[model samples]
Target: MKSTLYLLLQIFVLVIFRSDVFCQEAHKWGGQKDGTFSNPVLPADYSDLDAIRVGDDFYAISSTMQFSPGMVILHSKDLVNWEIAGHVVNDLTKVSPNLDWSSMNSYGRGIWAGSIRYYKNKFWVYFASPDDGFFMSSATDPKGPWEPLHKVWDVSGWDDCCSFCDDDGQLYFIATNFKLDPNNNKKYNIHLFKMSQDGKTLLPNTDSIIHQSPGSEANKLYKINGLYYHFFSEVKAEGRVMMMERSQNIHGPWEIRQLNHVNKTVDREPNQGGLIQLKDGKWWFFTHHGSGDWEGRAASLLPVTWIDGWPMIGEVGKDGIGNMVWSAKAPIAVNKALKIQTDDDFSAVTLRPQWEWNYQPRSDKWSLSARKGFLRLMAFRPLKPDDTVRILLRAGNTITQRSMRTKFNIATVKIDISGMYNGQFAGLTHFSTKSYCMIGIKQDGEDRKLVYSSDSQNLIGVTITGSNVWLRSSWDYQGLNRYFYSLNGKDFLPFGNSTQLTWGSYRGDRVGIFNFNRFATKGYIDLDYFDYQYSKQ
Candidate 1:
């Protein structure tokens, strides 16, 4: 009887423990047991990707548009598991003063659709800012110490640039001159220009119009098997389709073909990206699904094949075009799973790779070493017409990270409010251009209150005298979000109404930590740590 009772107790404990797990175990799309992986190697928005293989390692760069650390560089050995290696631009002020805290106007416009190449034994990254100009940066190591940003060309009305070097040591630059017509359709002229071998000066008389098509962008030039392959993305009646032009010579009458619908069932419009060959001599195309919704454009990997001197995406169809491969054997062996950074203890010497400021923060306003093991955020008066509405949107130093497409996610941060001044609000926020919610401490005169604010109104809650407080925001891919707080570290109580997280202006939702001064630039907040947890349901 005793042995039976012990066995029953063990079974009961196991059942109860498993029941407490909030997140469900879902498919980790990178790879599965049969040596195949599903679409979207990454569930988050890694828009406008340019991927290249350097020996056994792979490196990719993506557009981060309004985010401070301009071009984000990602690294992977197997092309399946990826993580943030570093960023190209550290100073948005280098782009322009308008990108700084005072103006806050560079949203959805800063850096767009750059290209990455392994050349001269170094990793070369090139991007163009519509408002600013063209820029380039290089690093011997992808995880830098990258060299400072260099202004390659100071011109506008152009984007989606790529660089190439030929066998004779002649270098060329290819991009699109996106002169919009009256109907707002892209003017669609792909231009080729001669560049200095050092990639600094653009020769004026050397410009050549390579191709013209509607929405012709994301131009990548490659010399494969003695043929110059020029890739372009164009919008069609069906959807966005991948286009490729090839010629035996760099300047030529090129042959163009529309590469579309590799696997129509999986994703009909997997367009606008680069292709590479693996170490095993297998070819693959890294693409972004054209159908971008609230989650933004997610990254997908598809197999590629070369037939009759033409590169085909996925498998060839009856029409001679390739279809999307919903599941294909891993191009490289499945290594350990990796992901972008999300949690922070503020213990490292530098901030985590995932964190990016809304704009380039003022140097005097924030620091990690002001207090040991804490992020010190000093409040500054926002430069908006009114401080009583959407103040956080205009406030600078709003550090943030992207929200992933998982079933369950919670972002929590512990803030010490002893440094807060009157009319100062510091808290954790779910930020988007359309909507936002914040649960944090607000100081008014002599009273300090814990408040939940959303949609231009504040719901004042408990009065707090303690120096430390915990704020949390939880959500899922469906956008159902709730804000919670904890007086102690253990017990959390929900406070705010559940709001649906929304996306806007070519960007996804971001979880952020913010501090703003409504009265004067006089207060500060110390962030003890930030914790992010997620799982699929």
Candidate 2:
């Protein structure tokens, strides 16, 4: 009897321990860990994210660079577990048919500082492309047919414009004008104007220079308890968030808050973000951190509290160390975790929502069918390998690691090079100036060859007419420096080491597949499938 009782106790203990482990893993993807905070909670490259709180719901939008589906819209309840609600821009061909990330025209250009607000039972989003101009779109529902883009103003170098609707129903637009005054040598200045009653255009004669801070960008205005607060970024060699308030009328005598300062991460220069008060009366600040390169800029969130009627962000205790809060539960839990499906079966007529084409994507460039479960990419004449116009996919999240696995042999993956205008081929690549790698098939007369190369600038390696090949690519935290190819999909062979490439004023690298067929022909390449997995590393 004693032996049986001891055995029963052991079984009970094991059952309890197993249940505990299961619960922990289920909560792993949701809640905050004990005493630990998740920095860059969003691992993907979500730069210049502006978050807005409406009731208990939180919505955010970020810069999409030249990607086809620009202006990604995200929703969160607890400020974690974000889901791609939808896209602001449906197609890029309507905007720019060709995108050049290397050219000065495309560098640091695209959607920036999107402002989301609820006004009179409608959702309004103000998005700006400094290279182009400012645009506004609205929808009654969060997910829907967002109204067509309405050009508000065509001022030169205008970026990061935000809108505020007063309690009296008067709408105002706040923004920074980059028109340089040759005499003063200053580039960016803040401006404000009241919108027409119809909301279709700006009200004339209401345009006025509200405030001008030298080198300041992304100016936003808010009203709280009869006080008008203006928030903006001071972009010196280093960047910092600056805030000022006024109790007087909208015209003048604004008092700059003495304690208004937010710390910038070593990577980012305090580019842009948003401030909101939670339903519980707690204040929170959301902003982006520059990753040294333009590509590395990712979004981060911190807590804020008002002390003596002024905002105190990232406050430090007596030890002079700032504490970032960690919450296991989201501010507002939804029906499901906010997520985007990354797994691809290559069996659909259209590309997955998680996939984005660099710059602009041709509508008929690629396709999928339910019968074959394979992705058929049409091949055409190749453009410059480094050009952003070539078909390229986007890499999201910085801290989350993604791995792609495929089993198809290289010989079976054939490319039809019949209609050649210039030169064209299909391959997998790490698309970034800082670093890149490609394993592709090149055409030689009627036969095809396999070529592997890296942009590290150290060495280039290619294997002509290689057979039975499986390729794998990855980008490490230090920058994309690792490359390994396989034949059986079990063991990988290290290729040539190379030097890193750098673009002007940008950081981070993107990994994806590319086909350099710019001639617009109908040739095609067969890909079995691509499996992408992400994990916190």
Candidate 3:
């Protein structure tokens, strides 16, 4: 049933605006520097993300599994141009000591789906781990000195969680739990728990099974127009699809609705994210495509239109469900497209906000002051000195950032290998837990050998004499990556055959500066600078 206002808006578009409002799809940059914008607001891996708009300021938080400085918080004013605001947890060890530099075992398991909401004059964030438990934090500001990660529940199996503060000041917790049966098959159930006023703990005896289905997760709750709406994702015949259930009461006789439209874009289905109603009464959904590929869960913004009290995201067809919108008007119109930092010189007292270590870093292992504008990494032995296949995957203290999807991506790093020890492997890497590729100089006794390695196999090696050498990695929009080396910074020669940037561990490929030793921790290197440049076309 269409609302009168919905009818009037369509009529207005047809009569006055003189355009088929539902003729909805276009392709270009997310922010085209014109009034228009496109899908995939970012070509980077910002997966399983949740976003909210407070006042006129929009903020988002994404899942950063096993990356130190735990959950990345992003800020945007117009919903098109985004920048890093900060991170939630500085030491992931707060979640688990295994997350500490010594253990370093929590891969693809640390932080799962979570929620961010503004409640009671404070910014609230809540998330669950499939293994560890549930956690919560609060702050006066979004770019924050967030309260130290507070473990709300120490019971595992609780996945995506959301917090809702009701009209009467009661806090509610909604999440999905994975229960393994005697057969070892998993049962999925969405549970609602009454949370304490302070958002610190779930009150005992308040857990209620609200909904159950296959693969139900990514929970979010909202109370709009006096009705309670619970949104989530479930595996359907169509694919992983977004879902919603609404009722006048918190628990009982809930009406289920599908939120997925036939995606006309390259995305499989953007099954996770948040929806917001604008101050001007327009609605927008910020989401990430659920499928993981070379580009992991790239984020896209969709316009939402409400019909008969239900929010229809993307292009609404006659059947009433939505279809993907490849391009749309900018949520907040601006002529200039804004972006975050990419190139880092390591001149700052600390790393730039875009960088994260493989896990919680040992302060003694890396430094900025030791080299006076260069990043100095002390080559340390791997925690598990045995995973010889992709040895870089097992090493600690590798600092990295997202390898954004683009028409072309080129990452170059200048290194001073004079202090390198023979047993050490230090250089530039595109590291994924499943597979990794490397192009760096290996120190064999006293000689430096230029090498190109993939999945820990030295695919090619050649003798090189250079204290200061430049290494480059380039990948096209779809092809395998190519590597090169330069004795002088100006002359780049191909190093080895191209290798695919494999995507796994629920993350896309990450550009990393890695250093680890096979024998012992006895070597070090100085990174002069890392220059990363990309083109969307």
Candidate 4:
């Protein structure tokens, strides 16, 4: 009987260990046994991403236009499944916060098209905020409290900076010149500069021209098997990806590669890409696809080959195929299958990394954790006369037409409107830059009503004059419109014409609870629960 008990104990221990391992593997965004893939691996407005592999670890950084915490760093063992490792700057003032929006700029003025490289036991990043200048920073670890900005070459209209340290430890900077012609002041060119021994500054005397495409951007340099290659985007009225190669030196008598991957056919425009070699000795290229106006861009990868010492990208026989494949298999380790959280429990110290503001965020705008399991937001004054400061929250990735059936109850939200603007309101909103729809509670005399409004100039199409109310909003892709608040959280009323507004800069619409108290005085709102149910349509 004692022998039997010992065998049973061994089985119990094995079962417990297997359960813990399963729980840990479920937190990651993807890694299913099926061959299906996630649409955007790095979701939530991340665009123009550049990634590199150092030994077994992978690191990536992308464009953060006008956002304060700029230059985000990501880590992954496999090319897929990335997480926010750290940030270069926590505050905007560190790298020029004040921006001029009237020039069609400021909103997207922070770092654009950053490149990450691991050199000589240190990780380095080269990024450009064209409005300011190009800058570089380095850290001992990929996840870092990185060193401050080391200004390299300061020139306006210079963006998408990339760097390479050659086999002999000589550093080179490859970037596009946005300056108009110094001669007739006509167009732009691709320029190269050699760096000093320390890699902190550029060598003053070593400036040369590698190639000049009138409207080209995102220039990158690579050397393989003693051959030097230059890759750039050749922007015509129609955008195209063009390549040129040289044999002798880094500064080259370069020759243009005949085949173009993006020539007004399968793809509308292909932008920046990082060329990397897999562990199995095969080459792969990662590039992005443009989404017109709604969604800024989506990333794609394609296989590349070296034929007679020249790189041939995409596949020749596949006929303009852009998705690349690397020989390295996905990492054996699994990611924790945690669902991307959108519903706020207000138990954490700060907002989730998924949230963003329309403009530069003020530190005092919102507060959390003081009230257990509740988020408190102080209303801000509006910039325009007709509008209130719409503190828009991000709608998560799971809000598809098919994913709306999952029932969520939020009837416990308690909001105090005694200190709001003369016409200020507080409720839930689904906002886009061009269009928006909201179901809110506004003061009517001395009472509150659940009123609905869309961009079509309809005010209070439906109303419920009550203090305790429940609101929900949903998108119908087939009809290309939105359905507004339901009193019981089951029935939804269509508010206006089809919302027609698609995703831009990133995917999905911005949907969250908000308060607009046009007056500058601080007023607070209490939310008990802001829950969303993810279901199959």
Candidate 5:
């Protein structure tokens, strides 16, 4: 009966749309016109997920470690379609200088995991830094001037953290300490602390060891049906699986169960996420595949079936264990095609939310106002340049955006290099952390040469006659990269050898505009516009 019902649903959807349109929407991301949505709802790298619904708006915050304006928050009308809501930490330098551009550190270690909750009429966010303690922020509106990151704890070695507000108005905080204590004992324990209801501070002498397991983290707490459910993940002998513990009291004497026990795609394990109960009382789970690739930790929505007070995520089996779901019905009835902003003319009052500097950028080096409508990037030497090899990886002024994982992607930028000084490299790059590739114009004495550089090799191409050159980067779903250049905006010439895109540093491959001087910090380039596409064009 189940199989027959599913077949009928499939037929119904195919009849609602043309076969080609249905096929394309099935293969693509986001909400389909026929009221169904594809899996990996967010097909790019939005790591370490946590989501909530405020009224009719669905908000999710993803981990954006090392990048400034830390912790990207996304807004959505339907759970399947999302947009950039805002960021949590406005100036990451307030958290630490190591995340700043000149420091050139924090490659893969910044904001790791945390929780988002609506308590006492405000939105509260709690997150953990591997080097820093738990940080908190709040805002009445999901988008806008969120309270600055307040340090709830000052100790380190703490990973995934969460917040819970009980019905009686008591607040509780939970976090995992995977590091050793003063005694050097291997402590993989989840510690629960009482917090002030105002969301200001942690209460003293209220810390309790609630649970312990090998490689335990990703803690989420909820009070449903007079029973408390503590959701987390633990790395058992079989691998990391979802675990749930329940009790009548917030504290111990708890019964535990493993919610899941498989990693069919071992690297991309469905481990960490947020659990939400919608307006109609139906539950949902938003999760990310654990290990990352070129498409880093993309977000997926799974239905939650409440069985005997237990929330079984994805497709629950007769054994009561749940498996990951690839496609499912939309949580709400809304017809909208959503997209992350990719095209920028540099004409707005501020940089588009889609763009982010490689790190906390040097304030005086980049300007959107220096020119009428172009983004001017001043070339500067890296704080510590490789004496043997001057690679773009070490360049500090690269502004970038994520490269979409689709059937095909084309990113093109128009750059004016007339202001470039000698010994400067300015151009378009794959912006990949590993096995990356870039094609740029090298400034020499009155002669501009096209150079294609990558992690393994750098090739010098033809010197162009024009001062303005157009650079293009094209990639397919397989993550194969190719480069092209054009003297005129109309026709493009393929210029470089083929290279591959790799998602390193827990982020996806990005499309970047890089500028640096190997000799002196005297050159600059103006980028007029950046246009991107992902469909079969």
Candidate 6:
């Protein structure tokens, strides 16, 4: 009896400990055990990044063109591990009526490069849409319930904007203007404008030319040690490289220098990014390597050293430019492993912070509450009456998250087709602006068929007679992906040739869970779960 009681107590303790463990899916790219980390800190595509440190916390915003909950805001403590804090824009329809699902034309042109700053007890985010105009959103907290987006400027042809609040309470705005330069026949001039105290309007006639060069953009401003420094990127013969100009005065004669390294191919030309100063009086540069692939531009954290009052990125060589370092000691000491985003089980009362719709999702079209433990996506028809072929890319309510970098990775989703109607298609996809491939199920009248569709071809496989099916896409670091199907959710079979992922527009490739009607809006599919398993090979 004593022995049996002891065994029962041990079992009870084991059960209690297991119950307390957190078991949601998670992946850390440069995870290390010994208070050290490595490069591509975020293995996903977090491009055109602007980061700001507030007290002990760091906040960053990345460009998410045409994706709803636009301008993904990320938070970090050590600048290596990150989490999805919130989004700047909740409903992109507020930006433009054309962005609605009915129109579906704003694929490559919603929110572009933006700046995030903290001032006067609030966090401010300012960004531009090439088609709409310049906009701003703010919140008392970076993990935000941000204010409704405010249109600061109702003009176009401008991109990559930053906001500055000076010591004397003067407000200023700097951005790249994309007007045809009659002299150079290009539109890469950097311009500065005065902003109102309310942060609502750009003062008329306050525009002044700061720098003009071929492909000059991605501007950032800093005032340090009584010196005004302006940072931007200019297209070089090799690739886009960093450029900086400084003057004692905000407006005056500014001396400029080209900051670059000779290892052009390895570093992919360190160009557009921002700078941050740590509490320990150390500075670091956050940059995106310009050489893009199917996965998109990746972010890098570089050590910054100021020599003779000029900030040098990477390692200062004989040419005064910094060379890229593949591995370096982490700047700060918070060694926890965290990822910006991950997979979903659809078990929460609200959508996971990592998932965002392709556009402002139609409320009536998708639901998480209707199905207690699943995401239900209702098929919607094309926005235009003349669009005879319903394109999967244009479908509203397509849920997506950034695809991370690993030697090998696989994304799988289990979808239920019981509610599917004729002409409805639901699947898992690898998506970008220029190309996309879907591995899913299509309904035709009473028959259900497995199908694989790419940019150039759409092929149908054998009929699947089941209420639920699992679809998957697997790829490697080289961006070659193949589709597969599993009827039992355990046994899987490959379906198609490998498709090379490609970058499109200003964004990288993303994995999406989508449902759409090819003929009419009459069906739906329930996604039981999404699983992402990956590791460096």
Provide the overall lDDT of each model, using Cα atoms, as 2-decimal numbers. 0.82, 0.57, 0.83, 0.56, 0.81, 0.81
Q: Where is model 2 more than 4 Å wrong at Cα?
A: 1-31, 96-105, 236-238, 258-267, 316-336, 339-341, 369-372, 382-423, 433-435, 456-469, 487-491, 498-507, 518-522
lDDT of 1 by residue, 1-537 (tens): 999999999988865653321111233455667777766677667889999998888889989888878788888888877889889999988877887888887777888898998877888888898867889888899888888889999888889999888878777899988886898766979899888988777887999998988888989999998999999888777667888999998887899998765222236367878899887787889887665545566787988878888888877888888876656788877776666678899998888899889988888999988998999999988877285566777888799888776667888899999999998988988877777888889899978998888886779999989989999898865667899998897899999788877676667788899898877989899999999987621
**Residues 1-537, model 6: lDDT tens digits:** 999999999988765653311110123345456665556676667888899899998888988887887898888888877889888888888888777776777777988898988887889889988877899988998767898889998888889999998889888999988877568576777889999997889999999998989888889988999889999988877678788899988885899987666334445666778889999999988777666656677777878889888888887889787777655678887546556557789999878788878877888988889889999999877554344233766677789988876768899999988999998888988888778888888899999999888878879898989899999889876678999999999999999778988778767889888888868879999989999987731
Indicate the worst ten consecutive residues by lDDT in candidate 5.
Answer: 18-27
Model 6, position 52, has a per-residue lDDT of 85
**For residue 256, what is the lDDT in candidate 1?**
92
Write one digit per residue (lDDT tens) for candidate 2, span 147-264: 8877777655787788888889999888888776878676776778899765657888887776776666756778887888877766444345444556556655677653233334
Give the alpha carbon lDDT tens digit for every residue of 88-191 in model 5. 88777776778888785777877778888997999999999888788999999877789877988887888888999999899999989987769987669999
lDDT (Cα, tens digit) per residue for candidate 4, span 1-537:
999999999988766753421211212223444432332333234456677888876677766665435676767665555566766655555556452111112544666776888887889888887766788888898667688877665656778778888999999888777776668654667778998766778778787776776666766777877778777766555455545556567776777763344532234344566777878777756566543323235454555666656666655545433322222233334353323344555567765543444434555655676467666666655444344332232211111111111112122233443344444567766555445666676654455555666656445555554434556655432214354565554566655444544443333345556665544545556665566543211
Worst 10 residues of 4 by lDDT: 396-405
Give each model a TM-score: 0.91, 0.78, 0.92, 0.74, 0.91, 0.90
Q: Which sections of candidate 3 miss by over 4 Å?
A: 1-28, 262-266, 335-337
Query: Clash number for model 5?
Result: 0
TM-score, model 1 to reference: 0.91
Candidate 5 RMSD to the correct structure: 5.7
RMSD of 4: 12.5
Error of 4 at 255 (Å): 3.0
In candidate 5, position 74 carries an lDDT of 85
Model 4 clash tally, residue pairs = 22
Clash tally, candidates in order: 5, 24, 1, 22, 0, 0
Please identify which of the two predictions, 1 or 5, would achieve the higher lDDT against the true structure: 1
Best by lDDT: 3
